[model samples]
Target: MTDRVLSGCRIIIVEDDYYQAHDCKQMLQQAGAKVVAVTAIVPDLPDLLAEGRIDAALIDINLGHSHTFDFARELQARSIPFAFLTGYDAGMLPDDLATNVCISKPADLHRVVSVIAGLASRGG
Candidate 1:
């Protein structure tokens, strides 16, 4: 294990799967991110964003029965930097979101740390 690089940054996780969410949280926390909240859907997302503390987000491409593209749209509108963390392959992502940073599930913790480091460095 390495020292946490994202020591003070706030992260929000949007994953519907309980085990996946737990894994993500553990990884981020290990990397020193302050995980403000984790949610399974977009309906409560706006409220969470309104709290004005999230530095970035790691979002699952699908949230149970719902796709997270709409949530991604909202994040874009707010100018929040986010990355897709999905079990699905990159080819499964929508055409419009193809350019966003994405990490395959069973993600490499170092890569995830680097991604968050870049986001934080960019003032996300």
Candidate 2:
């Protein structure tokens, strides 16, 4: 039962955990999104973004030694919509970033797909 909720959307996943990244990529693909890239390294994002159009991004807060706050700001500067898909609570993020959509880990695929669809549709 593919919902196709994210049909035609191009997305990137940035998560440090291999299994988590894989699961998210698979789920997004199943939901009719193009999983442009699944990367654990934050520094690889610029190269990946340059490769093609990305409708939205699912970023993890803590990528082991680094964080995605800077990248998130970059995305904002680009006017690209993105959401944090992290295990950490939304309240923990800096005040400016806390307002962005944040989905908890072990999330329901349906909810993930729904939120992504909304974000992508919002000029992403």
Candidate 3:
């Protein structure tokens, strides 16, 4: 990945684990993007989107007892690119969402950063 592939990009992080969220935020910022928010809860997605600029996102599949498929749908409809970072098998994702990318947990930070950078750079 380039040093500034994500420059000026605004990213949202939907992750339940505090440490993972924080680390992802730090890595993305280091890659030159602004992390708009790192949220565990999914309520008021519209309000969340309205709060600031968002170009892409990295989401965990499971949060508490709920899955983030609905949130993914919303982002899809808005033409915002996102990737699921989950420990679960990608087969668990719904067929409608099967086309979207899924990154397994215990991720390579370089790869994660590069993928998000590609998404933001290409308007994916």
Candidate topping TM-score: 3
* Per-residue lDDT of candidate 3, residues 3-116 (tens digit): 876889999999998888888888899889988888897746688667876789999999988999998998888888999998999999999999888888877788789889
Over 1-124, each residue of candidate 2 has an lDDT whose tens digit, in order, gives 3678888999988899888788778888998999887888775657776888889998999998998999988888877889998899898898878778999997676777888889999965
Best by lDDT: 3
Better of 2 and 3 by TM-score: 3
Off by over 4 Å in 3: none
Of the pair 1 and 3, which is ahead by lDDT? 3
- Total clashing pairs for each candidate: 0, 0, 0
Q: Scored by CA lDDT, what does every candidate get?
A: 0.82, 0.85, 0.86
Clashes of 1: 0
Off by over 4 Å in 2: none
Model 3 lDDT-worst window of ten: 41-50
